[model samples]
Target: MALVKVFSGSEILAQSLKVRIEAAGVNVIVKNNIQSSNMAGFGSLGQAVEVFIEDKDKEKAAQAIEDFKMGN
Candidate 1:
């Protein structure tokens, strides 16, 4: 199964998105999470968190992300 990038953002937002996507039955992998974990004061502001999902589930993942953005 090919993986596709669904979202990229701050660690907190990425984690939140991960949870939402998983709840929708889509698998998620997070990149740069370790980097965010090691960030110190003022270091996290520039750190990026990336979220990936199976290519087939991209649409569902995107919907979940958009719903999260809309506070749904």
Candidate 2:
């Protein structure tokens, strides 16, 4: 299945969103470019953490992300 990016933010926010999305029964993949950059001795310059999910779970994950943002 193809993967689709659903969210991009700080590392902490990405992890938080991952939990909420998984609770909605959608699997998550977190890509943390900030961490990679730090490991490579380059400081982050942008929103480097991203959350991704299978394209099939896009709708469900989107709702979960919205709810999380809404403080639900």
Candidate 3:
């Protein structure tokens, strides 16, 4: 799979997305070079990162990510 987006906040969510996209192609491109969001001063930040895989896997990845966040 190819790297698509790089983000942080929760690797679990990222892993779930990668799992769902395994059937397709593309993945959350997390690397040392990925620019991180500045939330140090922010009160609450949900889902610090967002990724997009193949169009076909988009739906599956989304659901799996949600489930993962829910401890599924």
Candidate 4:
């Protein structure tokens, strides 16, 4: 299954979305550039973290994300 990005923001927000999406029965993977850079002993100037889900679950995940954004 192809992975599609559903959200990109702070690591905290990404993790929050991950939990919400997973609760909706969608799998999630988080990519944190800052954390990766820190592991490599390099400083990252970017603060963006990404949350990905399978393309097959895109519609459901999208609605979940939207609800989250709407504070629902």
The model with the greater lDDT, 2 or 4, is: 2
TM accuracy, model 1: 0.73
Candidate RMSDs in order:
3.4, 1.2, 6.5, 1.2
Worst 10 residues of 2 by lDDT: 59-68
The count of backbone overlaps in candidate 3 is 0
| Candidate 2 TM-score over all chains jointly | 0.87
Each prediction's TM-score versus the true structure: 0.73, 0.87, 0.36, 0.88
As a TM-score, model 3 comes out at 0.36
Segments of candidate 1 deviating more than 4 angstroms: 33-47
Model 1, span 1-40: residue lDDT tens: 9988777787788899899999988999999855755664
Ranking by TM-score: 4, 2, 1, 3
- Give the alpha carbon lDDT tens digit for every residue of 1-72 in model 2: 999988888888889889999999998999999989989999897789999999999887878988878888
Give one digit per residue, the lDDT tens place, for model 3 in 31-54.
Answer: 321234343443435655555554
Clash pairs, model 4 backbone: none
**Per-model C-alpha lDDT, please?**
0.82, 0.89, 0.49, 0.86
Question: Can you list the residue pairs that collide in candidate 3?
Answer: none
lDDT of 3 at 50: 57
lDDT of 4 by residue, 1-72 (tens): 898988888888888889999988888999899888989999887556998899989887787899889988
